[model samples]
Structure formats: C-alpha cells, structure tokens
Target: MRPQYPFRVRHADVWRIALPACIAFITEPLAGLVDMTVIGRLGDASLLGGVVLGALVFNIILSLAYFLRIGTAGLTAQAIGARDPADGLLHAVRALLVGGLIGIGMIVLAVPLLMLSGWLLAPGDGVREALADYFYIRVWGAPFSLINFALLGWFYGRAEATTGMILQFIIHGINIAGSIVLVQGLGLGVEGAALGTVLGQIGASIIGLMLMLGHYGGLGQIVDRVRLGELFQRVALKRMFGLSRDLMIRSIALQATYAYFAAQGSRMGDIELAANAILLNLLFIIGFFMDGIAQAAEQLSGKALGANWQPAFEEAYRLSMIWGLIIAIVMGFGWYFFGPYIISLMTTRAPVQAYAVQFLGLAALCSLTFMPAFVFDGILVGTTQNVVMRNGMIASLVVFVGVAWLAQPLYGNTGLWLALHAWFIARGIIYWWALRRIRSRMFAQ
Candidate 1:
C-alpha cells in the first residue's frame, strides 16, 4: 500500500498539546494569583490595590513583546508543515536574539518606566513606592521573560506543545514556591512577590531554551551558516521586522484596550478594580483554553497552507470549532460553579466579593462567543493574516471603549461589567467576519 502522506489530524493532538499547555497557561497566571493572595493575606486593601495596579503596568510592557512569540509561531509552523528543518531552527534563533535586545532595552528604561508608571497610575506616594519596587524587580527579568516568550512561541508554532507545557510548569512551580516563602516566611511583602516572579521567569527561560535548542538535534547545525552571514541580511531582516512590526501593532491595540479597562476601573476605586482583577482572570481562562483549539488550528492550518492541501486547510476550522466549544463550555462551568468560592476567598470586603461574583457571572455570559473568536485568532495568526487580525482587534477596541464610556455614566459598576461582556461579543462578531472572508478567499482560488 502507498504511504498515506497526509496523516490524520486528531483531537488528541489538541488535548495532548493543550491539556498540559492549558494547565501550564492556567498555572502561569497563578503567579499573579499568588501575588494577590499573599498581598490580600496581609489584611491591607492598599497592598492589594498596589499589587493589582503594579502588575497591570508590568504586563503592558511585557505585552509589547508578544509578537516575538506569535510571529515566531506562524513562521515555525510553516517550517513544520514543509518538513523543512532550516526555517524552524532559524526561527528560534531570530526570536532568541530579539529577546536579548529587548532585555537590554528594558533595563535601560527601568527608571523611566517607574516614572511613567507612577505618572499613569497616579497612585499617591505610599502605593507608588510599593508599585515601584514591584516594577523594578520584575523589570530586571524582562530579558528572561521576553526570551521565554520567543522560545515558547516557537515551540507552540511547531506544535511541540508539551515542551512549552513542561517549561511553564517548571517556571510557575518554582515561582509559586518562591513567592510563598518570601512573602509569608520572610515577610518580604510586595518586593518578595516581585523577586519571586523574576526568579521564576529566569529559571524557566534557562530550561525552556535548553530543551528547545536540543529538540532539533543541536545548535551546531544553526551555528554553521547563520553565524557567517550579516545577522540582519536585508531579505531576512525585512521579514523579521515586517512581521514583528505588524504583530507589535496588534499587541499594542489589544494591550491598550485592557489598559483602558484597568484605567477605568482605577477611577472607579480599588474594590471595583480588585473585583475586575478577579473577574478578568476568570474571563481570561476562556482565552487560555480556547487558545488550545486556536493554536491547534494554527499549527494544522499552517501545515495545510504549506502543503497546499485545500481539504485539510478547510478541515482545520471545522475541527477547531468543534473542539473549541467543548473546552469553553467546560471552563464556563468551572467559572459558574467554583468561581465564587475562589473570589470570596481572595478578598475580605463584602462589596468586592459582591462585585466579583457579578462580574464573573457576566464573564460566563460573555464567553458564549469566546471560543469562536479564539479559534479565528489562531487561524489569522496561522494564515499570517496580521493586517486583518489587527483591524479586527482595533474594531473590537473601539466598540469596547465606546460602550464603556456610554454605559459607565448611566450604570456605574454594573454598566462597566455589561460593557466588558459586550466587548467580547462584539469581538467575536467582527473577527468571525474576517475569518470567514479568509476562508472564502482561500477556497475561491
């Protein structure tokens, strides 16, 4: 019998990759959860407020480098599909080199970052000082974190989800343990939380790089030709910067939208912000789980595109949606059943808990369309449909801001929650159109 050159795409691929990757993604957020827990344990709302505010600032900076992982994933997946060994390795190298430069740049801007964070967050001196400490310690780890983004992105791009999963486990496991030790045992407070984060990211980056490098035989293969050339050869550099630039635009818009959410919450006061922090994390789980399907689609679609297997390319979406909905429904239950217990445990204030429950409840509703949006996002990334993706995100942001501004004056906190939930729905609708358009164009040929 002839060899079946096109192997079947299994649901197991998603579970195999996404389950650990999902757990890893979930646990990675635990670092923030840890910070909130430790700080909340202090019996100081101010501390809770400061940590949440500080962390938001930290993520905004980190989010800018998201392209390093996402763009790398698209390029790497293409290599995997083609069975071409060269592109994947070179892809990893490109990401790592870029990661190093970002690290240095982060350090140089550290002081200014603090100044800017203070200016933007506009907390009084006491909160500002604590936030500054958190910012400084976390900032020092920028190189490691950014590099990890690149490495992990490449790993996912190649559908080597298990490697990224294990790396995340090791990273978060150490970070969580370190956080409890420093914050509780040593009484390091806010700074301890920051220190734990840095150590965890640094340790994880080291391990992730080792595994990723060793995954494809060894680095010697990459070192031979790549070392001799102009590191930024025009054609290659153009692709890197071009993809990087577009992805960066997408990240900025997405991050800015979240920033808008946080900034709006800040104006409403701390309990509202804390409640939002809790609620957003619950909503965030939807994205994490959906990414499993989306990423699987991303890998499969890229492979299909490379092979020009129109049927498999088409099958990827149908396959992704079927799987995506299942994961979202499971997470939604996790939210509805257990979320209140978790949120109540996190905060001491009655109003905070009340708001949290309400917001989380609405998140459950918001996620009805979450899976589709995510699967579509992966499709876009896989297709290298950056411009459309960017446009979709921008449109979503406008809807979000417009709705929030219009609603908040009338509904107060409830209005904010409503706006938040509606934003996801709007995102789902707009991106669905974009993805469908791509599907049509791909097949129309």
Candidate 2:
C-alpha cells in the first residue's frame, strides 16, 4: 500500500504537520520559561543565575546526544517512505536502546560531568551552590529524558505529529505544573525546579511505551515478530551509527557556539548573564516556530526520496521554505512589539529587565536571518545527507567564531548577537548550495 495523502506537497499538507509541531516546539521553551519565571521571582539573581548555569550544562549534554532523535527520524522516515514497517520499528528500537545506555552512562558519570562543566563554565561564586543542587538531582532523569527523544523521533518520522504534540504537551504540561507546585508552592527552590522536569520526563516515557505497544497491536505480537538477530543487523546499525556520529559532532559544534555565548556573558557580570539568559529563551521561542515548518520538510522530503519522486521532493522543499519565511516575518514583528513585556514578566530584577529590553531588538532580528537554517536542516536530516549537514555546521561554527572574535572586542554583547546571526546566515547559504548540487546527482540516476 502507498502512503496516504497526495504525493505532491500542498499548503494544507505542510500545515497538517507544521502546526502541531510548532505547538509542540514552543511547549519545550515554555517549560523552560516556567523554570526561569519561577526562579526569577525569588528576587535573587544568584538563584536564577544558578538555574541558568545548570540548564546550560544540560543543554550542551542533550545537544550532544541529539543524534538519537535526528538520526532515528531520518532512517525511520526513509523506511516509512519505502513502506517497510519492520525496518522503521527497528530504527526506533535501536535508538531507544542507545539512548537508554547513554542516559545510564550520564548518570554514572554525573559528578565528573558536573565538575567539568563548572570548570569550563566558571560560573560566578554566587550560583555554584544552587547549580550543584540542581545538577545532582536532575541527572537522575537522564534515562527517561533520552528515551523520550527516541519516542518523539519515531512519531515525527511516521508523520504522526499530532501524537508527538500530545506527548510534548504531557511532558511539558507536567513540567509546568510540577515546577509551580514544587518551587512556588513548596519553596524547594532550584532543586524543586529540576525535580519537576525530571518527573515530567519519567511520566512521558512510560506513556510513550504504552503507545508504542498499541501501535504494533500488542506486546505479544511484537515479541513474536521481532527477531533478536535481525534487531542487531550490522549493516543497519553501521548506517545508523555513522549518521549519528556525524550528527553528534555537528550538534557539539553548534552547542559549543552557544555555550561560548553564555560563558562570555557570564564574565561580564551576574546581571548580564541573567539578562542574556532571559533574552536567549525568547530567541528559542522564535526558533521553535520556524523549526515546526522544518519538520514538514523532514517528513515530506524523506517520503519523496523513498518513493523516487522528484516532483514531490521539489514541492516539499519549495513549500517548506515559503512557510518558514512567512513565520519568520511574523515572529520578527511580534517580538518587536511584545518582547519587552515578556522579558519584564520573566524577571523582576530591575537591572536584568532593563538589560534584556535594551538587547531585545538584536534577538528579534534573528528570526529573519536564522529561519533558513532551520528549514534547511529539516530537509538535510530527512534526506539522510549527514555529511553535508556535518560540513555545513562546522563551516558555520568557523564563521561564528570569526565574527565574534572581530566584533565582540569592539561592540560587546551586541557583537555576540551579530556573530550568532552570521552563523545562521552561513549555514543557510552552505546548505542551500550543497542541496542544489546534490539534487542533480541524487535524481539523475
């Protein structure tokens, strides 16, 4: 049987995936917002600073491991396009096993990881105690959190965005509720916030397992049908691992750029660091919307490739880019109008609020320059063009470093924002050129 929906990409088809994905994407940052808002209200910049530091470390770690989600999505989406359920299921399962093992490793090495992060980040003295408390408790959730990544990737590849959205809602909704109750109601501080997020991850992973079972009819049938020997097939594992390795390297480079941004901000002052963190979350909020459209590109492009339908592939790329640009424009204006109010709401500290307000424009402008990279990334991932993705990101990181080095010394934090935009622009251009060159070779045969 063929895949459902028209082969040609349509506006309605793109939104069918993008809308729900967009909603799902924002929920994550909203959860982060909830954490920031809860910690920020305490009137202690140090506590908020500590949470920021702890969160930054987790961000880098998760980013490094993000290949579990991305590689699985590309492989499963290809399997889906080929109408190979067995292969698709195998990809997801493999990713889950890998994610679980990585999570366990992270837990075992939690203390060392924390020590390394503290040394590299060199956070202010005021934030160290709270950061330690938050980091220690949060490491317990690593397994659940990583497993959830595989589950979400499975759904995305299947074009079951609604299911993915519902799962995200469950996880982030629980996070929001738990953080409020634990931190605000119980006054457990940064520890409460960390624990709240952990609870949400655990709850989602259990529910996701049930949903997986239901998808395949039942546990008994799946156990009988799935062979252990085939599950560890070398060819498939090598492909998955190779893709994951490149993606992992790509992710580290990307995260390192952002980490540098945070580290540099921290050096200026606690208030500057806190302000940048608030502003950074808003940037993430803008990014989530664009990323939602990117999800459309991932599924549609992969499906088209699997079917060997160039027309469908072209349509997917064109429509995805159009929608991404539209959303970027809207978000840019929206941020310009409402960013200050949102920043004020996130933090009551006068200095932090003022600083964030002053820099909001630079962040808003990011929507325009950064939108292309997000959309391009989806297509690259969907097509399983891992080498191109890896090379593009590394090149972009070089651009980021060069720009920052030249600009930061002269213009301060504003220069850092400019460097970030330069990176985004470089990525978009590199991907655009690479894809154009690849398309001829990919379909010419």
Give the top-scoring candidate (TM-score).
Answer: 2
Instruction: Report the Cα lDDT for candidate 2.
Output: 0.88
Q: Residue 310's C-alpha lDDT in candidate 1? A: 61
- When summed lDDT is taken over every stretch of 10 residues in candidate 2, the lowest stretch is 1-10
> What would the per-residue lDDT of candidate 2 be over residues 27-127, giving only the tens digit for each residue?
88778879999999998998998898898789878888898887778777878777785648888888999999999999999989999988987888888
TM-score of 2: 0.90
Residue 178 shift from truth in candidate 1, angstroms? 2.0
Query: Mind giving the per-residue lDDT tens digits that candidate 1 earns over 127-215?
Result: 87778778878888889988988888888888888888888887788778888999999999988888888898899898887786566
TM-score, candidate number 1: 0.88
After superposition, candidate 1 runs with Cα above 4 Å error:
1-5, 39-51, 186-189, 225-231, 262-277, 337-340, 354-361, 405-415, 440-445
The lDDT values for all models are 0.78, 0.88
